[model samples]
Target: MFLKVIKHKTAWLAVLAACLSACNTGNSNRPTDTPTSGTIHISVDETYEPLIEAELKVFHSLYPNTHIIADYKPEAECFKDLLNDSARLIIATRELNAQENAYFKQIKISPRSMLLAWDALALVTNRENPDSILTMDQVRNIMDGTDKERKWQIVFDNPNSSTVRYIRDSLNKGKPLPPNTMAAKTNPEVVDYVARNKAAIGVIGVNWISDPNDSTSIEFTNKVTVVKVRADYGSEFVKPYQAYIATGSYQLKRGCFFVLREPYRGLGTGFATFLGSYEGQLVIKRFRLFPARINAVFREANIQ
Candidate 1:
């Protein structure tokens, strides 16, 4: 009986030892949470949502463990979110200004801004419209409501949009946008307006007029015809093709930036790296935007 009791005690001790060993080994083997690999809260400008969404889908496929919660807002709203530290990432057409950069530095988070892609500011018109090309000066005259011939009727989204700002800055040359130019609340509304108005020309980001592979792109192309813009008569009235934008033929182009509050070390850093990587740039190319990589492939593609 004494020997049996001793054996029982030995068995219990062995079991405990095994469990303790397992607890220690399991903890050591478990994956650690990376600052950049976990759930990331990001804000995206509405104009870039489709491209971002497509890219995110590809990203998620590769890193299924990572989660991204994205809020789509206008560029101004995105900047506001970044300022408040409400988002770890902001994808927009513009970069931080000096004041905004100083604010980030004050907060002890000097953001790393990456220019991922180039997008064109495209002008659109109805398919039946005879004029398929316009000079910068002609667009300016129309926006200023000085073109008495009414050869170009202007239609666009909200005044706060990048499209409006580009037209106002480029065409108006710092002058106020003319009252005759119509402003719709949304891109779809602008498209609808232009579709119904034969003479009206809609100005929007080139992403809207992307090719038929993507649903949003198809929708825009079906509704309107993208007009070519020329710097002058000798220069080509180049449409916003990916190759054209990449090679600098498309003059009205903007950069898409990813602004992080701090030098991303974890998930933020990882995502930033991904955006600058070949795979991310491939997604950008697929969206018909000019990727920053500027590889030979980008030069060869005819993405119109």
Candidate 2:
């Protein structure tokens, strides 16, 4: 009887020990996962930082329980973050290519891509510079350092930036950018460089310089002039306004995409879907970028 009682107590002790061990190693046996309510990280192209930051502010206000961490870098680095699982989403100028799609297939993940807004690659010059208008060909030649019209110095944010890539692929037909391409650390720096140098032309995204509601825009434009660009020779020059971009008059417009690779309905999906929502589209318009889906209100008003 004594032996049996001792055996029973020992069994109870073993059971209690197992329970304690399991309790201490909470969720250790379960796979790591993200949910809509938890914290998550994303990567964005630095060119679009201002817009994304606004969107995140609104998103966080709405979803107070969810915290989003954003790392703004070159577009290439954003893609790398997505592949390495360091980021659940990436905002960039382009979608994943066939090679990237194949890698996702091999990894048993399907990347979701959504176009969030229409943005333009704005060309800017010093406010004091009289050369405000340029033909697309001239711009291309300047980029390639072959423009004999003037000793041109083209400035861009980063060598690997999406702005540079877009210009290179669109204007140069996948050719390498010219040696005259001067690199600035950021779009604002590009503006600063152009503002200080009379011969420099800064190529940047329009959002950085178009929002009248934002003081930064005033500061940027106060220092430099947003050069009007013609689509081709003998074409009318146009600035990168929302109307111009929407009407296909903005010559350097590009689409911004949200590339999400979340396997489950996680925070990434939530954010991507939020960006495509009507409210999200409104946010895009508020930031002076044309929404992928038109959602702006138009109320007729007469002024005397």
Candidate 3:
């Protein structure tokens, strides 16, 4: 009986030792990155470069110890970075689909995503272009390859950009872009192309030309004419103004989202949180995009 009791106690001691070892190992494996310090890599859709750049500037100033390296590319490549574990966070126009969530689940990493803002695509043309207004039907015709006359040369920032995807999915009904559509390396390039071309209309994020505080954006705005769009043949034309974006009056509106795969409350989480905070939403408002996380009232009044 004495021998059996001793054996049982020894077995219990071994199990307790193993459990303690595992607990210590798990504690050691905790991520080193934190909200106020540590470095992180994030991917952002290039269309949002200006907006994100401004946001990062403020973030870095507030949290001087934290560093975030951002890779600006097409929305598709941003997703690739997140899936391959090269980036801890990604800013894009849409959230992950069912497949993406499942893949994260399989990897034992539950990703989180939040809507940051309501963004719109602006159609900009050369100052010399006489046609500065378009109906949704006309825009659809241009995108679906039905405009045989090819009245305008359609330009996009990139073939794989979120702008292209938005048009294809929302306007073209999943159909591919027209063969004659032109793609520039960046939004600025697209604006330059349109500024120089007589018949080119560049599709770009509203933020690129909407920021009055940004000298580059003002220069681009001066170089091209922002086209006013109407939802239908008989509707009123409207530019992608903040009030219009908030009220869904802008025809090319889409939601901006940040998808994070951070394993802890790291720098990525800090930055993501900032994007939805009051200060961050103020930045978004300054850029003329509609903030999703903040409340703002719009009233109709006639201008003098």
Candidate 4:
């Protein structure tokens, strides 16, 4: 009888030990940070500085406990930070490719990504420059240095910026930039260059000059004239307005993607969720960019 009692107690102790072991394993896999709290580092493509700054400002106001440290740099640098594990989240123009997916799989992390907004590249020139309308063919010619007239000088925010990559991959068809293509350090520098040089045309993100509520953006618009673009010679020229961007009238449109490498439900995931949420989408809409995550309705209006 005593032997039977000893065996039963041993079984009970074993079961208890197994339960504790499982609990420990689960706790180890749990995330250290919660959605509404904790500090995190993130990298954002410099093209999105104004839009993201507005987002972070509102996020901080809503969740006082959470803090996000953002580093705005060229798009290539943003990806490097993600690959090196220096940033938990990154705002980029594109999502991960096959190689990037394999790298994350090897690290035992399944990265998450979502489309946040539809962005556009603005072709800006000096206010005094009369050539403000361009067709897709003419723009291509200017970029490839085939425009025999060479009427305008081309400038980009940075050599490694997504704007340069977009022009090369999408418009230039994987061709190298022309020898005369200039590189400014930042988007603001591109604007400044165009503002000062009557013959210079700057390629920059639309968000820089699209924010009506932002004083800096308003000032930028006043400094340089945004060129209207048509898909072809006969199509109507359209600006990168939200309505036009939504309807595919704008010719140089791209997507804004938010990628997170977090292994658990951390602050990075929280911020990514917020970017797709209705409130966040509203913020993106206010900046004049088309929000991709939400359904937006537009109506035509006439004024007397």
lDDT of each: 0.78, 0.85, 0.91, 0.91
- TM-score computed on alpha carbons, candidate 2: 0.91
- Residue 217, model 2: lDDT of 85
Q: Write the per-residue lDDT of candidate 2 for residues 1-304, one digit (tens) a residue.
A: 9999999999999999999999879868453434447788899999998888888988888888888899999999999999999998999999999999999999999888978888888899988889998888887888777788788788989888998898788888888877777899999999989989998899888889877788998899889988888775335888887877876777788999999987777888888888888877888898778898765544556998
Candidates in order, TM-scores: namely 0.81, 0.91, 0.89, 0.89
Minimal lDDT window, size 10, model 4: 230-239
Clashing pairs in 4: none
Provide the lDDT at 208 for model 2.
90
lDDT (C-alpha) at residue 293 in model 3 = 98
Task: Arrange candidates, best TM-score first.
Answer: 2, 4, 3, 1
Task: Candidate 1: list runs displaced more than 4 Å.
Answer: 1-36, 151-153, 298-304
Please give the RMSD of candidate 3 to the true structure. Answer: 5.8
- Per-residue C-alpha lDDT of model 3 across residues 184-276, encoded as one tens digit per residue: 989999999999999898999999998888899999999999999886533689999998888776778999999998888888999999999
Q: How close is candidate 3 to the true structure, as a TM-score?
A: 0.89
The numbered model that scores best in TM-score is 2
Deviation from native of the Cα of residue 49 in model 4, angstroms: 0.5
Off by over 4 Å in 3: 1-30, 148-150
